[model samples]
Target: MSASHVVYVLSCADDSLYTGYTTDLERRVAEHNAGEGAKYTRGRTPVAVVHSESHESRSAALSREYEIKQLSRARKLELVGGE
Candidate 1:
């Protein structure tokens, strides 16, 4: 079976950004929306997956997540089309 891997960015209710890696992007996003995801998102609630990249492996997706997280807010804003 193919391994599921993803790097995703969520726009929280407060308009903050959250970055993470997941094996199941849909389920992870649903969890975040349900307020059962990360602690940072718990208080924010109503998170949405604004961006996602699939990778061949978990390690690769995690590496991408780190890279995305390290980007400045301006760079990230550019990535998300400044929405």
Candidate 2:
């Protein structure tokens, strides 16, 4: 897993989905919970990883993150097995 990057979906406090790329998934999650991560997540504290996808490279993870971000909420929920 260390050979690749990761794209994760976070379930926020207000029940919103947040997608992002990270090299260290555990640390990133901790950062988000600490409110020291993305500005979007700062207000959405107590975020949790509902899903994570692996990519071969940082660029690949980033591209996937963009794709996931563009997905509709319903689609995103489907991706995370919420529907």
Candidate 3:
């Protein structure tokens, strides 16, 4: 079986939300916490994966990530089960 792609939401240290797609969720989260991930998340260290969804393709995961990023903060929070 092939690796699944993931769309994820992170709760940042500054109380902000971040969305991204990756095939290796654990490694990506570790990179974010280690200050080696996306530039937007670099300074927002100590991020926690508040939400995540798996997809069969990279394209699907990336599209979903974009959709999540476009949602309002309130909606995004709701998507994360209000966490």
lDDT tens readout by residue for model 2, 4-72:
699999999999999998889999999999989999999988999999998888888899999999999
On lDDT, the stronger of 2 and 3 is: 2
lDDT of each: 0.87, 0.93, 0.92
What does each candidate score in C-alpha RMSD?
A: 1.4, 1.3, 1.3
Task: State how far residue 13 of model 2 sits from its true place (Å).
Answer: 0.4
lDDT of 2: 0.93
The TM-scores, one per candidate, come to: 0.91, 0.94, 0.93
lDDT of 3 by residue, 1-83 (tens): 66489999999999999998988999999999999999999998899999999998888888889899899999998999994
Name the runs in model 2 displaced over 4 angstroms: none
Best by lDDT: 2
Better model by TM-score: candidate 1 vs candidate 3: 3
Candidate order, TM-score descending: 2, 3, 1
TM-score of candidate 3 to 2 decimals? 0.93
